[model samples]
Target: MQAFIGASLLSSSAAQPKRKPFEIYDRRLQGFTLRVQSTGVRSYYARFGRNRRVVLGKVGTLAPEEARERCQKVLGHFAHGRHPLHGIGGTDAITLGMFIADTYTTWVKASRPRTAANTLEKLHRLFRTWYPEPLTAITLERIESWKARRLNAGRSAATVLRDLFTLSSVLRRAVTVGELTENPVRRVDKPRIDRRGKVRFLDQAEESRLRDALKARDEEMQKLRTAANERRQKRHKELLPRLTHFGDHLTPALLLSMNTGLRRGEVLKLRWACVDFDRRLLTVEGRNAKNRQTRHVPLNEEAMSALQRWREQSGSRRRLFDVATGFRTAWEKLLKRATITRFRWHDLRHHFASRLVQHGVPLNTVRDLLGHSSVAMSLRYAHLAPDQRREAVAKLNEKPLLALTMRLQWDGFPAGSHYRIDSMVEREGLEPSTPAL
Candidate 1:
């Protein structure tokens, strides 16, 4: 049985009932010594080993009841012929090699989106440092020390934290499955990303700049297509159905990704059936999505027209593009033509969101449309929310406001200034100005 001690703000060792600090009275074989000592803290640690002093928790970290409970638990383990401090040796001392492999396999089957594989790659790279020992033998101190060492070696804290989380999560699962007794990865904090990975997407002006560029390119491509067709006609059946000149092929694909907001992978895998021309909707099933959830997008007239033209060009209700291998090859050529050297295909998705925001779509609406799991994940588009509000203001058709102003100036408020035209000015707080309608 364990004893209880009262707690206080002025609480110290003097206020407690004690035989001695960590007093251990031996009643077992070999020998045992119990004494409370400081374990890098002010809390009392009840140690119970002859040579190796085992640390319990802090004095106040656990309440008197909890301390007693833990003591009884340790005592129970001892009663069962197990060591009270460390281990009774039931854990199978699996090599890190075997453990990591098992973890990777479990993750591949149960978790995905490539994060699982990426995590295993890090653990594999770090395996030489922390393998071959009993997993339970790996303590918090050891892991923290390794993390510090990695940080000192100029590795990133976020990377270290992520790697540790992956490895530690697997070991924790092992403990749950009765393979280990403790988790070493809990309470580890991840490194904070700088600027939260900020990137300035196209604002209204930049968007206009790009659209103007695309228009110019479209005019150029039309001329190029005309020339290519003329050359094909002159050559007269010398080839395989007269492929489009590179310019025509590229501009449209760029236009499609930017206009439709489909992910690169989703765009590449887009099928003819996904587009509902009648409803002006593109149904992207969940299986093809990054999160394995389906998404649908209502096509604007422009996007639908592009799809229609693509369908006609490609000859059916399936994939729009026939050279469906890699869009990147075409993207590189297009970006070169457009003089955009630094952007990525993923940037098109950002561009899409930025456009909607500029045109006044709410962030929540965009989040739902994009299938973000949380608003926090969707907050990257918050900068767009302000633009949405701005867009709503812009949409009031200020020319109508101007027209109203002109009408009031010429006709003297059009018989009444207030919306309720017959109401008294003093009663309605009305003025001789253009009335709100």
Candidate 2:
């Protein structure tokens, strides 16, 4: 309730309290005050913008001088039209863990569940060290050092970059909610990723091998399931059902991925409602799509036939495949059984795009089918378009000449060729500057 010239009087001033709570303003620093509670507790706060005030810290944790300095920062932010609690939060006590749990993850789960899950996993694994630290304690230098440590620890640039981006996004959200004045991640340079333009897709031989392998796998599964069912019924008389559910999913899932160019998440999350048998269209809803954009992809004969067979077998099942449990293990086994090497599930998308480009589908159409946000993403497949570069080169000479001037010299052509040359030159309205012999 009174002004003080120096911080030396703060302890004495806080030792005594009135019947109700009151604030003692700093004579040295405007907007800085120490709040004295009726219980004889005191804390520093910065008052700004009418009735708005943000806590700096308790008296014991921050000296009066330190509190005044922090208040000056709040005043500076308020001058720039930013909230005083931008970096410190409402109470200056919220930690990185609390901010992520209470705010960042909630928004991410609503807007992009896949990203939320992935980022949460990576952050927990890579950044648990910072969980207990206050949000304001994280700095640009610390982020750069963390990136360097990750790179030195044999983490890929792409993976580290993804983790860094997730951290950056969380901090940026903090900024939006006035929990951070600035994002430290923005000041640090992202790791340089060397992504060459290599489009990995199945060629004819690889495709044949893959199909044969899949057929073999299906047949092998059928044999095993039949044997299991026979033994369960006749020999064991067991109460449990057959274990054949696992094998049935892999073939159909791979088939759908290869034919439709669907990402793994999209394929796993596919439902019956999104597929229209009548229209031969598979619709990826905005919520389920990677870019949050809806896209309708046409089903070719192969995809259509596969879907029809799957629908009959699914028999009112909400999901087309029981792949919700996940396919990583089965996928690895299938690849190993088929002797396929160095191919991930995403390569199937590339296979689809490659086939389309080789068959002369336009890049923009591919972009739409793939649900890419921009044509630049689809441009990687432009090289695969059949005869595109060749056609461009062919345009160099609209009408190519085929005649040969054999036995000719600097002089005019021989008697019979003279008419041809003269008429051609006259027609073109050009000069014949052949030196006379």
Candidate 3:
């Protein structure tokens, strides 16, 4: 039979002695008791459901009365068919690696494949060390320290912020799925970027130099193609096709980028189906656009000509560019040949927007042409239209305002008359001008 136990017995060391682990019933509370081990260590627990047992806490840590109250709650949960630790993962087995690999990755890929790939790359690059750790181990202090280190290492605030955002998103998903109790990232602040960073775009001189370099490169590629054609044989024909003129693709790609303001990915992913040469319109489908909204860009004289020439020369029936690889190498070579410095491929898009704004294109029109999700994003180029600002200010110098000022100053009296007119004299309490007759 189990002996009834109470707070007095738990407080008095003499009431307990070294013995095998055994349970004593609490007279004050049914189904709640204190369990004593052979070495005299004691803990409280509640038993229910025939075989169900829940440990409340250690003897001193939780008094008998409090333990009994907790036991009552435990029994309540058991009666409702709920495990006390159900929401917390079983044995705390949810590690960051498991959550990211098995949960977040699968969900992200299904929802947004391109975003998933980019996010995975950033996660691996920035958080590989934390991948195998428990999700709970990613504390707010650790994240703040990591962010400080990243900033100290000369990483751009925007880049570091993006990485932090990605990590926070994964943890947020974990919280949603019950793999984590909370997202620590919610407690941390994000890095701020400098708002005044320069927007790089090619000026007229730089553009002319770049074009001259492209022309030279084009001539060289033509000569190489001619030589390769003359020396072609049956087995060598396979290699000869790969040696096509670089200018055939690169020049057209550069020209198209500068003319249409299409992003690099959008430019590369362009398909023949979206190009309506007859309508003179190029469509960036919603699926491929960054903002996930379809935008139609009308081809200009230069862009249309480049596309036509490329289609005729390369015979690339599917994608516009035949080059399968990336543009970093060719871009760097082109920059070097042109003797231009500190320019990236994305700057070509900036060049297009700047030219349009300078030529008096409305900002809303530029926003639509660039496929920006918001007008605020296109506002960066608004300052480029200084001529418009000057014209607006120049309107203040027009004759209408000057004429109104003159009328106010003379009060409808003739400038040549010494005396005021009848209307002006009555208003100003002065004598009316004598009639000339």
Candidate 4:
């Protein structure tokens, strides 16, 4: 029904529908509407183009005059061939903060739960100044200026690049939802990252020390558990279970990652259903994997033993390792005890790949075992396989061609005179050294 929407008209029950909601068009302004629901909820809407409707606000929150002003602004933007949400002066214009808080937050939480919090935190922290600014204002110049500031403030190029990628992802999502015409971050030149930087893996001595430390840690934890159980028994309380297997999940978890090269998240999220004892295989489920593709890793003797002991201790729990927060404290202590420096948990995976490559395993095979999508990622360990390259070159020494050439040299044939050698070979009824031209 057409009416001059105001406080008196909005408060009247005669304008409301009985069964379903209905829109009341403004008599003074064309395409301005007040939607009155059957539940007595009223909201202002502005219709533009053929049927595009933009909600201004609810009745009680936005007064009639204010909603009318907003509606006029939206209609004016449309009349000038501009999108109300994209127009700077329009009340419905979407800001960076609004888009992220209202739209991107919910999506990233559901789609990328593992890194959702980190991504959101980075967006809020890194782009805090841009929060109030419009998404269209995130231009190449502003980002380059931000990049320069970040670099000057001691942030690495890799760190700045990661921040840029996160921002670009948000902008790309905005473009996908028609909020923006394009992602301006795409036009910005990405920071050059060194792909072949030095990989930090454990050496033999460091690995041995780390193993010793882990053993010591297990013994210490077992001793503490036994002491606690003994005290419990003395107090006539229910006796805690004795420590039979390894102390805690730390040792087994570390060993499993070192052996299987599963990522930290993948290991923590691993379920018992994915581990096959009979087949000696560990499956990384697609949902838990970083690449979102399932891949099975064969468990070696050490890996199998670690899982077996851990399973006995873990009982019927679904997850193999139920560590939600990770073992950072325990890992740090273990590293300090071992006197290892400049190594991260992720380096364990690199160590696994390095050992395989050094032992003559093919790079493609290592790539598959590490669950990398491409062999290019495994190339960092290529330098470790100097023996393999040496052997490849050594194979040339065993070729019959080498022997034949040496024999010809011993028979007084001058080197680098292929024409003369070919004529001599033809005269002597031997096959020509070179093919006839």
Could you tell me the lDDT of residue 353 within candidate 3? Answer: 94
Q: Give the root-mean-square deviation of each candidate in angstroms.
A: 16.6, 8.7, 11.1, 8.1
For model 4, residues 314-401, the per-residue Cα lDDT tens digits are: 7879998888779899899899999998899999999999888889899999989888899998888899889867988997766455
Candidate 2 lDDT by residue in tens digits, 1-437:
55772456664645458899887887767788888899978888888877867788887787777778788888897787554544543435767887787567778898676667887888788888999888888899899999999899999999899888889888898888777789999888988875537889887887888888878877787678778778788876763433333247777778888888999889888889999999999998887888888889888888887778666655667877766578888788877877788999999999998888899889988988898888888888988874979888986654322332433333445434542464676788876456465
Clashing pairs in 1: 21-36, 22-34, 22-35, 22-36, 24-34, 43-59, 272-318, 286-293, 286-294
- lDDT for position 198 in model 1: 61
What residue runs in model 3 are displaced by over 4 Å at the alpha carbon? 1-92, 233-246, 391-437
Candidate 2 Cα misplacement greater than 4 A, ranges: 1-94, 194-196, 231-247, 393-437
Best by TM-score: 4
Candidate 3 least-lDDT 10 residues: 82-91
In order, the Cα lDDT scores of the candidates are 0.60, 0.78, 0.78, 0.84
Candidate 1 lowest-lDDT run of ten: 25-34
Error of 3 at 215 (Å): 1.0
